[model samples]
Target: MPRFAANLSMLYPQHDFLDRFAAAAADGFEAVEYLFPYDYSTQELRARLSDNGLVQALFNAPPGDWAAGERGIASLPGREAEFRDGIHQALEYAAVLGNDRIHVMAGLLPDEALRGKHQAVYQENLAFAAAEAAKAGITVLIEPINTRDMPGFFLNRQDQAHAIREAVGASNLKVQFDFYHCQIVEGDVSTTLRRDFANVGHIQIASVPERHEPNLGELNYANLFNLIDSLGYSGWVGCEYRPKGDTHEGLAWLRQWKAQQA
Candidate 1:
């Protein structure tokens, strides 16, 4: 069975951020992930993880000015320095939290005409991040987000993400395959997973269209989970979805999956 990591950023919205760690643990999640850990001291965050016996499965590198609506600066031409600084900061936090993987968000591209410029900057920035992370024994992940949810997200397709990873040629650089996004951008999720399985570094899931519990969506997560096991994927599968009702109440799918596995 694939290990599931509760995405605290989306799950358990009822509790304070710090409190969510324990809530996830009590609900049977062995690991947790969130959007940004920069706001809290590493000691505070680490303590929460240790106290709850939850592993820090993943977290994103700082995206520039999230409050100002800048998702990420990695692919932006003039923000290379800021992007690099963010990568360093993320690495520092990862070390303290004992996380081995970090996701790099590719910022929005408002103008399609400037895609060439953005792609060049993105490739260079990723290469730099991968090299730095490699020295720390960490894997750098790039995810292809759906344009509908993130209208101007630079990376939106599985093939595009893998191509950029190949072009960058960093052995430690890999793709963060999110099934929710993949289903939105391209319908053939299973085939894409199999085709890109080797290059994948991480996995995430949510219901399609509504972005709720995996079992509520158009996709058959049970079969997909089985397929993932068959493919020999031994990585954390992030439950990156918003709950339709009470978070704990919405965890029936998880309990069912675990029971089926047993």
Candidate 2:
């Protein structure tokens, strides 16, 4: 079955975290994903998932200074301690929620004083984090945010993600390929996906032009998903889009469109 994860951040912005979680389960979604679940207790969140019979698919590892507009700092210099602490905190939540992967958003670059020395530190920290994640049976993912969409992000291209994965040298470290961002930054999504199939770990999408529901967007999700299925991808597909109205009302497109995929 193709698991659908309601992006609580965009889908149910108006609802409390757990309420939307319950709603996702009620709507027949077997899995759920959230951008940041730091505000809720893993135990309490886990209980809700259990009661609703939903799988915890994925969650963020924490992007530092979300409020200060700092974006993230995983690869930034002199902040290795902060970065590792964030990963540890994320494991606690992910372990409780039964989530296997963590998205580590690459934060903004540090001051030029540390520029030459910082990237080495970033790679080393990633290797350490990956090793730790492997011990916990959890995989750590690095997502590249396109500069066109989100400027000042450290990793803004697939090549950067690929380099990080290669440097980590751990099976547990992989790249998160968000199609919407990839399409905007670099077209030919299928070719890039196929080329990096081994290293690409997770995917998220909204749509072009509107960044809303899938069927209304330009990208042919049916063909895209067909390609994914043909690749024997058994992983989940995250419905990480903004709902036009209530999240539930926007989701009717899911059942309405996928049925035609047959």
Candidate 3:
């Protein structure tokens, strides 16, 4: 069965970031992932994970100047040095956190005219990051964020992500298959999973349109989970969603799923 990892960034917002580790454990999550871990010291983060008996499953590399609207620097030409530096920083944390994958965000593209140029830059940067991460036994991930959620995002389709991974030509370069975004971008989630399972290194989920709990979505997660298990996708499925109500209260679906699995 696919193991579930609470997305601490979205799921445990009621508590402070550090305290959310315990909250996730209390909620019966065996693993957790967040957007970034730069805010806390590696020792502190590691200690929290160890204490909570949770594994750090995934996280993103620094998206430059997030508040200023720089989602990522990897595909931005002339920001090569900054992107490389971000990779080094991410690896430093991964070493201590013991996580194996890092999602390299592709920032928004203001000019569609520069698509080819930006794509080349993205591929090159991914290759470089993959080389560095491979040294630390880490995999570099690229995700296809839906345009509706993130208009003009650089990477926005599964085929695009797969092509980039091929162009990068690195064993460690993989796709972070997010069901929420995939459903928004392309309708057939199950087929896509089977078709690209080889390229997929990790998976994430949230309901379509509202981005809530999996059970509340139009997509049948229970069946999808069965498909995932049958397909032998032995990777973490990140619960990356906004709670429709109280976080714990919104987990009735999870409780039921766990009961079924048990």
Give Cα-based local distance difference scores for all models: 0.95, 0.80, 0.92
Return the TM-score for candidate 3, rounded to 2 decimals. 0.98
State candidate 2's TM-score: 0.93
TM-scores, in order shown?
0.99, 0.93, 0.98
Give lDDT tens digits, candidate 3, residues 49-72.
999999999999999998887889
By TM-score, the best candidate is 1
Q: What is the lDDT of residue 104 in candidate 1?
A: 95
Candidates 1 and 2 compared: the better one by lDDT is: 1
| Cα shift from native, residue 171, model 2 (Å) | 1.3
lDDT of 2 by residue, 54-117 (tens): 9988988778888988776677776788989988998888878899998887777645556446
| Candidate 1 lDDT score at position 164 | 96
Residue-pair clash count for candidate 2:
1
Q: Which 10 successive residues of model 2 have the least lDDT summed?
A: 110-119
lDDT, candidate 1, at 185: 96
Q: Which stretches of candidate 1 lie over 4 Å from their true place?
A: none
